[model samples]
Target: MGTKTPTEADILRPIKNTSTTYLALVAIAGLAFVLFLIGWSYQLAEGMIVTGLSDWGSGGGVTWGVYIGAFIWWVGIAHGGIILSAAVRLLGMDRYMPVARLAEMLTIAGLSAAGFYIVVHLGRPDRMVTSVVGHYHITVHASPLVWDVTVITAYFVLTATYLGLTLRYDVTRLRDQLPDRFEPIYKGLTIGYTEREDAIVQRMVWWLALAIIIMAPLLLHGGVIPWLFAVLPTYPTWYGGVQGPQFLTIALTSAISGVILLSFAFRRGYDWDHIITDDVFRGLLLWLGFFCLLFLWLQLQQNVTGLFKPPVDVGHAAEGRLGHPVYLTAMSLVFLVLSYIFAQAIRPALFTKKRAAVAALMVLTATLLEKILFVVEGFFHPTFDIYGATPGTYFPSWIEIASITGTVGMVSLFFLTVAKVVPVVELHAIEHLQGDDHE
Candidate 1:
């Protein structure tokens, strides 16, 4: 007999199944999250001194360190995740349907992590409510930080609402088989939901997807986040117009890499090889290579132009940006990964699941390191150096390290917990696949 077509039960197995392995993973994640909270409490007690972060050009210290770097990394991942989902919906790319919700879940987790970093960076978390949220007088034009908060908040809500609205359709369809305990939740989700309601939902979701696709590349990363750095004429490296596109390209690269990793983990745990097939990996890898190339090109654009006839500040900054050992290593890794990806594309036999996964990991690491370097270097060497030409030193403190680990753990815990309740893979998408298979 030919391979059996997977049914709804197969997709829902993760929801019903219980295993010691699953519990162990959840326990680990919970522990990490708790540990992170403890670290934060310590930081709160001792004050921001416990962190390497300090005022810019003051006390020979750079104001942004791991916290701001992490913020950028997570936000990049969040931007990329939702963009993937939006593209899938808008383009009718059913080939990627199996991974859509997974990507969407990643967006929520990434955004949450980003928000957590912002809170941790604030040092006085209460002031977020008192200073920003409480005061209505702050205009978007007032500060780049305020602009970042505004757009990030908006993006989070829009993505969360998009996820919630889409889940209603699945909840309604699976209402009968879903656990009785979840009946109330399902009812709340499916209230007034009918088969005919899907048409209305699809239309609404399509428009929302359109809006996000526009907002992500144009407004979020390309607009506000980059503006925070790019608009500063004092920061020679960051003052250029290229930061927006550079950030967006790297964001897409990191986002694709994250999705690939999540897809691999879920596939291994749930035995989803058939649904999340080799083609999915191949397609995503191609996109990763495309972004990798764009990122490399942009790096060259920034470096080459900055090096030529550069002002004193730009020349000084370029030396650190282009000549740093870590930066050089990351750029080399990008080139190797991109070359490997292209080689595999030309000769299909060279490609393997493991190879693609490794390439994705390389890209994620390189992008993250690059982002951290950008933040630290930009702060260290300002346009008007108060500390002469020498930049301050920064290494993440234990508190910062713990917070990073804890945020990662929280993201894992979220997905693990959600998998037990909602089907991580979409049933409706699978139904469509089945129909096409039969035809």
Candidate 2:
């Protein structure tokens, strides 16, 4: 018998059916998030001192630590995720169509997680309102914090609008087949829908995709986020023009890796082999390799300039990074993944979905470590020696550590919940595949 064809029913399986494994995943994710909340609450009660983060100078420590690092990591993932989706649409990369919506959704989850990190790192939640919102007019020009908040909020709105418009089309066409329990959501999504609006919506989406693509390198990852650190002359490790491209490459690599892992999970859990296809995985892996190469190249550029015939401060920052085991491990992981990708490209038989997923995992881990070290070391080796000695050692307290797990759990739950409410895979993808089958 020939292989079976996928239909809308396949896309709607999670919405209509329940599984033991699904429930188990939900339980685990929920528990992790709850634990994070508990840790956060304890921090709230005991104060920011519990996080082990301290002021610089006389305090003999860095104010920013894992929280800021993780914040940047999450922002990169979010920015890159949307860019991936936008590229698929604007560039007409049909092979990646199946994963486009997944990337868009990842943007939403990632931005949400990043936003939460800001709130968590603020020490007091009210500071967000008082320090950011209340003082926005005065600080807007001077504070990178305000710039960071403004850009993130703007991008979040853009991504949400883009996702919402696409969802309207999907929800309208699949309304009858969708669960009535979610009818209100579907109705709200398609409130002003009509078949006559299809072409117009497509055009709107196209324009939006174009906008996202244009803004990515200029405004999102490559711009504001890296600029937050890059313009600061006090931090030798972070202050440089190269940060723009370096941050963009890392964002793309991390985001692509995230999409690969999510795609693999859904493909396995929903038996969506025909829908997602191994070909898609191969293409994604190739893209991952491309970005990883850029990421490493940028690192080399930074290291060489800082190490060879460099000023005193630059040499110290470079030496500190080169001497760190964490930095070495991160670089090694990316190199290994890159090598595997190249080897697989030469000999297709070497490629396997499991291996691809593993490669993605390694890249994600590598990027996270690289980003954390970037933030920590920037503060660790600043030009000014206000402390008059080495700043006291720093490590993330248990609460700080728990925040990572908690944010991850939060993202997991977002996927789990959203999957149940709507088709994670786009309806157009199914129709396109069906058309190919018919031909």
Candidate 3:
């Protein structure tokens, strides 16, 4: 008659069990990813001209389009995901412990998607090695593209190390119950593990969390990614001081939205109602709302400055953004989601996980649209009028469109594969819950 207590077995369910639904999900995700590969291969054989992108002036169109916008969007999600996880650890936010590892895993998947975008956008993938890696020393000083690559690599390494260290503790304790098929991975993870090192690893993780929190504003989304666009004075739509905070807020909102969607999926699939509770969803929604408010405020600041008796070029860019249907739709979606969040805050009875999930989906869709518009509109109204009377138009080609589905499928597959290898829910979370019950 009483509520059941959660145990390690609950955390390990993904590793120990498989169902028809799970297999079906794997098949669907795999098929989507394969379709993306087919698209990419065609593009590679045909060339960048196969997609919607084209050079400025002569081509009368934008060189960067959905690919670059999606790249920035994915980076924002990755940067914000790590920040959320770091905050949970550094601030001792025990209530969110259940989803901390989920956030970290999201960071890994997001960065991979972002990196993939860079390679896809390059046309010739080998240029990544020759232009970026081979010339890092020279490019690091002058190239924002190189800076973007550098920071992403650094963040990925840090997050991977942070994840590996935590897994050592869990794998060691649960080795007996774990599948022998993954014994090699377990051995490598716990190669030098000992109970005495637990305290040391905790200290190291704490410092890593602190480092991540600090680097976010200085080196990640708030810094390098926006700087890529912000420093380009030729592009009136992107040039300004407002970009840093604007990008940061959008990153946080987008990342929180992603976490909400992911948490909902795992909770439903694993029946983790008790672990990732309704209360956790409520808290996450509130945080998402807060960031959404900041995101809108930043947009207002940019619009006000641009629309009010500004330079001709700046005003033209502002007009383009305000007049765009996609931009209006994106802003409206955010406003609606924010309104629902505010209403729920007043009447807690209004909240439901399904509604929250829907809101998250809206936010994700809005952010993606906003980002793509930001990139396109910047090109549409550049300061230099090299095109003269010629007008530029753009739309995502089928290959470009399939890239999104492919990347989403890839991330989903990453989660599915990782779940079968290790517990997606942290063992520490279960231990913490049990400790609270004892108290």
TM-score of each: 0.96, 0.98, 0.98
Please, what are the lDDT tens digits per residue for candidate 1 over residues 1-439? 1155657887888899878899999999999999989989988898888786775565777788878887898899999999999999999888888899998899899999999888888999997888778774665558888888999999999998888889998888887888998777778777887788789888998999999999987889778899889999998878989999999998999999989988888888877877788889999999999999999999999888889988888988998888887789889889999999999999999998888888888987788788888888898778888667678877778877787779889999989988988888888777876876687
lDDT of 3 by residue, 1-439 (tens): 0056779998898888899999999999999999999999998998998896866667877898989988888888888998999999999998888999999999999999999999999999999999998998999999999999999999999999999899998998888989999989999999978999999999999999999999999889889999999999999999998999999999999999999999999989988998898889999999999999999999999999999999999998998899889999999999999999999999999999999999999999999999999998888898987768445888888988888888989999999999999888788989988887776
The residue-level lDDT of candidate 1 at 42 comes to 88
- List runs of model 2 lying over 4 Å from the truth: 389-391
Order of the predicted models by TM-score, top scorer first: 3, 2, 1
Candidate 1 stretches with Cα past 4 Å from truth are: none
Ten consecutive residues with minimal summed lDDT in candidate 3? 1-10
Q: What do the candidate models score in CA lDDT, each in turn? A: 0.86, 0.91, 0.91
Q: Tell me the tens digit of each residue's lDDT in model 2 across 169-240.
A: 888878888888987888888897888888998899899999888888998898989999999998899999
Write the candidate numbers in order of decreasing lDDT.
Answer: 3, 2, 1
Alpha-carbon RMSD of each model? 1.7, 1.3, 1.3
